[model samples]
Target chain A: MERPEAPEGAVWAEHVAPDGYTHRVLARGTVFRLANPEGGACAHVLLHHVDQPWERLNVADTVKVQWNAYGGHLLLSDQGRVLASVESESGYDALCGTTPKGRDMFVRAAAKHGLGKRDLPPSLSFFQGARVRPDGSLHFTGPAGDVVTLRAELPLVVLIANTAHPLDPDGACTRLEVTAWRDQPTGPDDPLWTATPEGRRAFENTHEYLSARGSA
Target chain B: MTVVAANAGWSALIGAGQTLTIVDLEGNQAVDFLVYSAADTAERYSAQDTITAQGNIFLTTGSVLMSNERNPLMTVVEDTCGRHDTIGGACSKESNTLRYGHHTRPQHACVENFLAEGAKWGLGKRDLVSNVNWYMNVPVEQDGTLGIVDGISSPGLKVVLRAEVDVIVLVSNCPQVNNPCNGFNPTPVRLEVA
Candidate 1:
């Protein structure tokens, strides 16, 4: 993985190669962005509260609370805490889940880096489009360039792995560029801060936890 | 190769042809487990697939863990605990609140143990799935209802698994105190790889 040139005034940037992975702890109010420079690429993203590790992102809860599996909004933690809210996304499919091949490849890649299965968390598949049928099978629609920006609600330890979704046909690995910067407060009335009822609860829980711990 | 403390979590890479023996060091303890194909993180242990393939809800000697992809990841080669629950699943804060009470929310649970331990290897919550509860005695009533009862396993009981492929196994020394699965008190377990 080569370090990418950060945009003007950005905190950090990196270019993740195919099968490459990166883990970083970003402070709350950080704006992180992932851009698929090439058309066909997907990244698996996992988020955890930096301090309260147990209070981590729960994909099931996120899906259930919003009744949507598409990734373009607030990602909720198990405690109903908002970990990160999507600022923008392009070229990603929200409907398709992980494919056996994609999962296997990620596991192998993690193993090579001395990480085991436990490290292989479920990720929000970004940039691969698909539609699910009535029978629970997924059909790939097409491919496009996907770029997503997220605002961290709590200090988070995020893991991003450059992997393909099962819907993707095997091809040359695509390059992924990531950038992060400090974000200014957009206030409580911002839609990003008030996306869903569950998100509001999560934010409250996080705030309460922080306040109780004297970290607020 | 590891001794998972009571209410803690342990994870390891068990290569193909390797065997992992889990011992009930203090007896009547439940060890929650999840496995994935080392080659692909997506190919993870699936309780539904395994139960459907074996026609049994309880895992024992000779039970082959089937992955979501319907591939074998590991095979149970030895068992002194008699049976393990594939349906009880791991204890989580949500489940704790639902079954026990909201007061139990702050109590530690298996999902917490898994996330805390798994983070060391980059795992997050999305990786969690229906997990195997070793030493737990969740019996299916004739009407298809399930009951969490006292474990059939005593001290010194053990179960062993042989990895059919290079695999990663995650274990949560269950911290569930609101249920009889851990005898209402969680304890340590021993992991030996051979």
Candidate 2:
């Protein structure tokens, strides 16, 4: 995996080879972006608030609460708070699987932090996406140079493992690059929070939780 | 046969083609249930696959629980309660504290039960996933908001499942005292193998 140059003045950047993983404690308002330069490289990502690991990513509630799984949607915690919002995406995927799976890799990454299997929850995958039919049929859409950007709505620990996603068909993932930059966090005044009734409620839950602690 | 005490846990290596009957001996008790392939625990119940396959979230009689690999692990053979919840996952102290407040942090939760009971089989936290909440009622509105409310089941109501393969079954009789899912009162249930 060739290393890509980090963007100028970027907070952080890293090249994740196939079978490699990374974890970072990012502050609220971090603009995190992941790219599949060569394609077929799926990132099985997990997230938890830096201060509160219990409020981790819940893919079930994320899909159920949003009623749709796609880019620009809010990914929620089981407690109904918006952990991060998929701000933009090209190769969109909602599933993870196959060899060196995100699940096992996640366990290892979590264990590094003294967090075990119990700390992990269902997560989202990027790079290889699926477009489903009404009858429950679906196919993959893995495009090269695909990218996704996520805006953290809270201080969080973002973990990424370059693992195979079932839709990729490669049975193994490839090299990927990630970079995080500073940005303004999503707040109640932000339209991202008021986009939908569901989004609004989730943001409200997030807002109340944050406000109670005097966090702006 | 096992009479799981109130707020206790139970498990079994259910053989393929055999059925395990879960009787809600006391009404409104939410049972948090999880299952894994006895041959390869990596293949465990995937709520995503199950809901995707069924085109619905609520599980009931005839619902085939699917694994993360998209294979059927079990089938609901009988469901007198009619609808079971795959959306309202097992509760935990972390979540209990998040929702109810810090005072409830010491209270036992379904996650603890799974960890303690699952340890007997060499399983740990990594093995737990979004679990089935038997007899728990979580209504989803058109806006996708979920409300964990009182159950529709009554005392002695039963839900039975036949193993589609050799599988390890783990259960936590939900001890949540913060929500109405268990009517804020925990109780015991009965499990019978046939």
Candidate 3:
């Protein structure tokens, strides 16, 4: 089901790069940040609109796409629209190979960013284990939980499928929640998020109109 | 707007609110860099973590840089020119020999510069990982391949990273003459850490 055929007039919403593969966008305005392994510029698709309409979709805005052998609707966004989607691909074991696994660092940073321990979805399964390092490459936990080791060099994105314990009933796969920058809290304690440049401009105009109304 | 130059061998520390600007006074210079936790030098920049967090193969402005332990290292505050390289890992001795002719194995590269400087502050080889090529450009081919192309960066072009915390910065004005990344003319660079 690679390149699941989209219906007519369907906007190219987002680009998905499967495990062991790299997906590049020919359009601009499509911004992509690495999911787990997290440090690189916001990779923009070569199109004029980087953010697709799919990014704004919520639970009801489900557009069926081929998921791990099946399609399911999961709670996608929040009131603030920070989180755009909650994806779970079954039957395929994949990993955010670049991200760290520990909760301590994640907790600390999340707290600083207003994402407390409670913020993480309670339904999310957690894992705490060290990966086996093979001769020169990294060792991975396969979809069947078998230790598959390889000797690869640095700067590599590695994903092992068919883990014994899939995050869901289907095989393991990377679940990414598409997000927006402006909707996210600036800091843990900060109640208000920073608005984008356009948002800020609109806010100012609205505030001015309200002020004038109050005076009149 | 700010300029700092690096002599043959030098290091600098960049603090918060201030940005470190690297300039290639002469064209074709590759700047090798390493970042560490200012509060604790034990933990260093982790390439895997960074790549995962950012969700891309390259680094440039607007990227919220992450550390190995999954901490925010810095953010690309501003960039006059766009498109930096994150997939093209820093150059090393073995790579120098392999990429170039075997006889060019002895060339000093960004990797060595990072290790040597980090050692001065109690860092080591394990600390080195993926880095951002500020002005370097590598375009993917039609077949989904990568090639080091002539840089799209020009003189006066700069990339800025705002420190999320007090960060220790190390950079080596690249001396690689083998590829077009450095314009076949590795030159000195300016370092401004204010």
Give one digit per residue, the lDDT tens place, for model 2 in B112-140: 89989899989876677788999987665
Any runs in candidate 2 off by more than 4 Å, and if so which? A1-7, A11-29, A33-44, A48-56, A60-120, A125-179, A182-216
DockQ of each: 0.06, 0.15, 0.03
Q: What is the lDDT, from 0 to 100, of the residue A83 in candidate 2?
A: 86
DockQ leader: 2
Name the docking class for model 1: incorrect
Error of 2 at A62 (Å): 7.0
Error of 1 at B86 (Å): 14
lDDT string for model 1 (A78-176, tens) is 665678877544523333345554556555654554455555434466766554343223455555556788888888877777766655556335877
Q: Candidate 3's residue-wise lDDT over B1-194, tens digit each?
A: 33334324455566766677666665545566667778786455554455445554456677776765568877887776666655455665544443443466677777677777877877664345455566777553322234577887777666677888888877766666777888887666666665
TM-scores, in order shown?
0.55, 0.66, 0.50
Alpha carbon deviation, residue A99, candidate 3 (Å): 3.0
Model 3 iRMS: 21.2
- Cα error of candidate 1 at position A76, Å: 2.4
**Pairs with backbone N, CA or C atoms under 3 Å apart (clashes), candidate 2:** A92-A129, A93-A129, A117-B125, A117-B126, A118-B125
Minimum summed lDDT over a 10-residue window in model 3 chain B is located at B1-10
What TM-score would you give candidate 2 relative to the actual structure?
0.66
The weakest ten consecutive residues by lDDT in model 2 chain A span: A91-100
Ranking, TM-score, top scorer first: 2, 1, 3
Q: What lDDT tens digits, residue by residue, belong to model 1 across residues B1-194?
A: 78889999988988999999999998999999999888887678876457546655578998999887779999999998778876556777864543454567899888898888767766667678667888987654322234578888898899999999999889999998976788888888999989
